[model samples]
Target chain A: MSEINSSKTVSIISRQAPYGSNRAHQSLDIALAAAVFEQAVNYIFMGDGVYQLLGNQNATSIQSKTLVNALETLDLYGIESIFIDSQSLRERNLTPKDLALNASIVSRGEIAKIVRASDSVFNL
Target chain B: MSTLHTVSKAPSFRLLETCLSIIQAGDAVLFIEDGVYHCQQSTELLRNSEVKFYCLREDLIARGLIDRKLDTIETVNTQGFVDLCVQHDGIVNWF
Candidate 1:
């Protein structure tokens, strides 16, 4: 039995790139926390947010931890479903191979469907 | 005396527009944080040759924008940021 009375489907749409702002971290943290609570969490990377999935990131010089570390833990928390906007990736000249994690490349219509199915939406 | 204008937000915000409008010749604008996204809008900034343009190298690299950065804007490190501050008489922060 889940701890919470209602397990709402929470969707976190991250639009900012990692290290540029805290929004990316904030979204990941919330998604993990929500998943821990036994809620169905959907994490979607769009726009600049797609940059968060890029590999070969070393933030040591900047004195910041690489967000990819936390991103790797999402699956361990049972948050397996990760989505990335296809247009965003194409516009940024990034391909699925460039990302550190495995995420489903979704279109605008598909993204809208996910958002619509979500019980709660957080656009960061 | 010159000013070191720091922009920490994206061009989507009117802050950059306003900052550019009021910036004087010899002033420098340093794009930090999300401001590095302004690399896409470098052509607009090029209109003012008198004003200098810079971006935090760490921030740019973190966003995977190092290769995509424009030639006109110089990349600087944190230490270089401090140097720019020292070189200017005042600082203007545009959020």
Candidate 2:
């Protein structure tokens, strides 16, 4: 009972790619903190957010920090429920093999279940 | 259980006004990115209520509006930004 009371599930929705704005990094920061606190974390890549999962990103040309390294660390934090939007991936012509990290390709219906199960949702 | 509302757009955007309307009495509002340009306009939101107001220090310096901030709008760094997020049960990013 104590364990159940102490842990809250947090869903962090990332909706943008790296380099274009600061949001991608900011959302990661929140997820990192939530993981450290031992909360169950779900990092959902939605809409443009799926772009963040692309592998071998080098922002050096753009003079921005590459999130490729951080994206790889999601598994280490016990945040195993990373979900990428299926529609977004198909629209962008990307496949699971294109992403740096492995993620569940979820349809909108599956995504809704994830959201409904969360105690809190962070929109970034 | 209050919400930490983050606004990253300028006052001209409907986002800022929409945030103001939905914010409850105890909610905290933080101005980030171009949202710092609207710090003065936000003063009206805090005039009669207990809603907390903060602006990201780095964003304010970048925009060159440091000296003109209203007395009520406190400035916070990135760590403070994280603390605010933790203090609230929920977060609403009004982009």
Top candidate when judged by DockQ against the true structure:
2
Predictions in order: lDDT: 0.83, 0.80
Error of 2 at B53 (Å): 28
Off by over 4 Å in 2: A1-5, B1-94
lDDT of 1 by residue, A22-111 (tens): 999999999989998999999988778999998999888799999988897799999987999898899899999999999899986677
**Chain B TM-score, candidates in order:** 0.94, 0.89
Which predicted model would earn the best lDDT? 1
Per-model clash counts, in order, read 0, 0
lDDT of 1 by residue, B6-56 (tens): 889887774566556546668799999999998855566556888899999
